[model samples]
Target: MMRARTRKLIGTVALIIFLGVYAWVAAVIGAGRISLAPAWAQFAYFLAAGLLWVLPAGLLIRWMQRAD
Candidate 1:
């Protein structure tokens, strides 16, 4: 069984890396593709992209909390 502390540390690191990569990709997309989108579409796209990260993060948190 994995230790709680280890899981936490690993989860934290993974989350940080994931967020960094996700943000970079989002930024690149925003700069390249989203810039040409209409105002309302840009708003919706950014809003969806911003919130989508939470889904995977939630799963990661749940996994990190497991006692096993």
Candidate 2:
């Protein structure tokens, strides 16, 4: 099993990479399709996209903080 420090370091890097890719994808999709959508639809899409990363990140963080 990995040590706590190793887990945190790995998790931190993973989270950074995950968020960067997620944001890029979200921006691309938002610009390509969501921009043409109605205001409400755009709002909904952006809102959901904005918050959707938390779940996976939260789980990763929990894992990172888990006892070794």
Candidate 3:
């Protein structure tokens, strides 16, 4: 059981890293289209990016809980 827990934790960490980098890249690509966008637009863009990350993270959390 302990081993399973450790594996889940590692998997969750990897998921976070993967999702974070992917989201960042996606955001950067989106940002490139708006060269003159305002500061508020950038802030809103990141907020949207974070919200998108949450859906996958919820799945990761459920998987980690079941790993035990």
**What's the lDDT for candidate 1?**
0.95
Candidate 3 at 48: error in angstroms? Answer: 1.8
TM-score of 3: 0.56
Task: Judge candidate 2 against the unseen true structure and give its global Cα lDDT, from 0 to 1.
Answer: 0.97
Would you list the C-alpha lDDT of every candidate in the order shown?
0.95, 0.97, 0.74
Clashes of 3: 0
Clashing pairs in 2: none
Across residues 1-68, which tens digit of lDDT does each residue of candidate 3 receive?
46666868786787979887977787686669644678888777767866777777777777667734
RMSD list, candidates in order: 0.9, 0.5, 3.6
Ranking by TM-score: 2, 1, 3
| Per-residue lDDT of model 2, residues 14-43, tens digit only | 999999999999999999989999999999
Best by lDDT: 2
lDDT of 1 by residue, 1-68 (tens): 88988999999999999999999999899899799999998999899999999999999999999986
